[model samples]
Target: MSSILRRIFKGKDQQHQIVIIGLDSAGKTTIVNRLLRSEFIPTTRTLGVNYRTVKYRQIMFSLIDLGGQEIYRNLLWQPSLEKADAIVFVLDSADLRISEASKAFWESIQQNENAPVLFIANKIDLPGARTFDTIVQDLDLTRATRSSRPVGLFRISAKTGENFYDAFDWLADVVVGSESVFKCKLRTVILIDLDSHKIWTTKFSSLKNEILDEFNRSISETMHELMKEPAGMEVIIASDLQLVVVKNHPLVVGLIIGYSDSVVRSKLIAERLMNTASSSIEIGEFSSDVLTKLLKRQWPLDIYKSKPRSD
Candidate 1:
């Protein structure tokens, strides 16, 4: 049972309690099914609670999926929220129940203060899905960030599996308790050579050229606007994307990331990489491979803080 496992691994590093809660038809159980079975199946309304143990990246997760109905909310949510090391709150983005879901979301999260929340705007593949920005405003999620809790809002589709792993990967990183800077999902890393007027960039996720061009223009505009002021780092958050730009002498480094948290830590990472690139090579000299390697070293794969033993 999950209780036995929790007692056995209470203070241990390798196991964590992950609680998933949302209103009915919000795709909470469906997401868990996909993660555990890697396939989708028709799910019925959960009557109470479902428990499963999953091993991801060598870490054990005792996933507690709670029913979204009001009766269960009054009875079962508190205990599970108390034990959760990480919490996932799912919302149906295409459904016209924002007011209801928003109320439910605020109610559930208020029960637990310490658990980091992975706020998922699910059903994004649907034609009627709301934008992430709209959902955030409707839910008033900024209040959570202002509280200084490490919360990440991610858009995902349980049916298409789009951005599915990204949501859980962030949850895993937070549950493992890594540094906030290292937990960021870096989508694109760009370095602008101010002296040579050349741009070198690399992307971790598959991104369209238009998106890249937009980021480039935004970075360039920000750099020029800030050129008159003192040199430093700046974070620009628009919708789901976060742009972190660092200016150090002749080089300006920009990082496009998914999470809105960790602005200070991300600036540190960018400045360190900028310093490395500026000292290691000449302006406009960085090839694609060299730039990719440098960025990877600075923002390595977020999982696995230590290697699994061969035994």
Candidate 2:
């Protein structure tokens, strides 16, 4: 039965092409680097398109960071949309004419009716940064979404690492959500030791030990290749329940969910889990059964069935 279910739930891990489009000096490359390294690095303007792949959990996000110069801005979105799963439109939040940037953003997405855009309000760490509600009002995002499908805007500071995980988590979930069944309720809360790579999971989980091993190994390998620890509120928005992974030092806590959990839930639970695991465990005292029992005692099955707070 588990094997059959695995076969049924397969094929959502295909490489997804996500292009990062924004104005020149809007911190496009810096945002990608921040996702890669979790810290700000000095960057120059992108002369042409910058291509990089972000391997997160089961998906390889082919992040095409396009050069946003006036000359290159004219290159139309039709060609890019031919293969993309989603559009990630980034804007310079501190720019005085944010509405102008929004206009350009709508213009780009309108050209490709197929791809849903995840609009990012970047550079929020800078002075004069605009608020998310302000951008929505100014950009008329409500109007934009009314005419389109699956559009979302988020306020992110790539420089300071605020709300980056939440945005990326939703982006991945949105992309995968269109393909297969994404658990709208919580599915899995995996506790993996960064040092030993042992896996502990939640109930009714379909992930086999071998499959779980792949996810486990990739965590460290990804961190090594990207020079970024799996820090921040890391969520793997898989095709099933959206996967949220929060890393605290030695222990990484991954939660797979269906609906958008409230901001309070997403941040606090994963954090508290990470803290509990890191602070409680001994070197060789870990096992899947033991952790599962402990998790049930602490979290319980009723917790997973609870409806997530949308507002």
Candidate 3:
């Protein structure tokens, strides 16, 4: 399915920036090398910052590895956080003092609260390394989640490459799809379940956010009226914007497109969304968070011409 989607949106490139920040000797450099270089290579402590770009799903993930020494943390953090789309905070699992110091750096941040943070309990290869659960408790992650940021924790070994792909997968998954690559007239993508009253959406305009809750309610009502057969569409087409819905049992996927968008393209995306929702890991009382992740997979980004990818 991914192969087919790649064929359709093959040329367009979306760029996202990610920065890695942690204390010195916490293996930030090791983690960076593990990702950019196919093989794990011995890494020296970074004096300042290291940068690399990787391509995935037509998006350029610009990774910045910032030096984590105390003297440089203040000077390095603000600028890096300001430009970051996501932040990876690495903690030295075997060193409690380093973990405490890293916490101080994280708490000092006053901006970019919306940027999702993926906390990596790194250096898990050590015999005395703290367990993931222990680190989570010590850091008070429960309190952190109640805050605005989208936070996640993972245990990783930069040396052995354990859970390496899983860690990167988490990063890419959290970084929202770029609007730069979307063709004009594509408005929004929404996912909902019939068995549960929950919805997730990625909208193209601010006006959509104002009307989304009410629009969603109307859609539910319209579905009951028009979907007598248990599977179909209920649309609202205005002069400027239009809506298209596709459904399979227990689930419905809708696309709010500008009237100018290609009918062929819109229909293809709707079908893709429906198929994915139907085959999703689970249904009934499904999570909007999980659905949001799935919805992004079907977003259409048309690559126009061959060139170097830039962020």
Candidate 4:
């Protein structure tokens, strides 16, 4: 097995492996760079696979950005397949010749009995790009239904950062929920279920207690009138350091806290969260609730929540 595969399969740490594959010039590298928030001019080809680590909502991911050249297609199986928690297949919406390559990559991922896959039709900003409906029909993904089938199909513009977060968030959800099926090492991560309004975190000493206390305090402060309602709380200890809490109907005005090695990085993320909240003035009711929860829990709560005492 390659070193990349070995580390993913044999490592003692909990890290979700996601592979990004598609046809050449399908904007795979562009999407990867956009996700990483880095700027490097496009190169000819990516040898083997390039990897990067990204943290979203306290979930750490090892994203493997694979080359999409025809010569490298055969190298995608075996070692790479052994440890993937999810697969993202990108397609060039404007290039018919390369669309076949995207389908082939999807087929390889389907052969793997691991987690589900996400299909992304990239380069939507291009004029000749195929419509999402056409791509879905041509890929036959709309009719595709397996217990572990592709969870979603997205049309995106990597250059414009459109629909990127939606794709990444979907992958993160699948990775956190797929139990020992992929032989993945459990790590210190948190899973926030928007539908159920719950949060699941890897148990870590006093971390769970600290988080819960903060959450409770914030909810009480933000939704004082709503507290009389029977709020649901489900706590599960998967291991010594993992705690999963399902809090029903999370309050909209609660706090969001995030931890990172550097204070500067945390501050930057906080600023972004503030901007998002400010710009979402007209979002729908459901979206507003979800956004409020994400902002309150995933960003730096210490900087945002400052309300009067609730005596």
Models 1 onward score TM values of: 0.57, 0.61, 0.52, 0.53
The TM-score leader among the candidates is 2
Per-residue lDDT for 303 in model 2? 56
Candidate 2 — which residues are off by over 4 angstroms? 1-13, 76-78, 178-268, 271-294, 298-311
lDDT tens readout by residue for model 2, 32-118: 886565557889878888889875435568888888877777773456755678888888888886666876787788777778788
Clashes of each: 0, 6, 2, 11
**Listing every candidate in turn, what is its Cα RMSD in Å to the true structure after a full C-alpha superposition?**
12.2, 8.8, 16.5, 13.9
Best candidate according to lDDT: 1
For residues 1-311, what per-residue lDDT tens digits would candidate 4 score against the true structure? Answer: 89999887564356778777887788877877765542234656677778888654345778888777777777765467667787788888998874476467567666676667788888887999988888777777755544545566778778654555556556665666643211211122333334345443332223355656555554444344434443322212221221212133332222222321222232234334434443343353235455546545664233333231221
Report every candidate's CA lDDT. Answer: 0.75, 0.67, 0.65, 0.54
Cα distance off (Å), candidate 4, residue 243: 27
On TM-score, who's better, 1 or 4?
1
Comparing 1 and 2 by TM-score, which wins?
Answer: 2
lDDT of 3: 0.65
Off by over 4 Å in 1: 1-13, 179-311
Q: How many backbone clashes does candidate 1 have?
A: 0
**Cα lDDT of model 3 by residue, 1-311, tens digit:** 59878875653455678888877888888887765553468887798888888653234678898887777778988888888888888888898685465475466334477788878888787998988778777877667667786777788788765555456655665675333232324456777666664566766454444456656665776677534556644445443455666666666777766543333355556667666665553634345565555554445242112221231
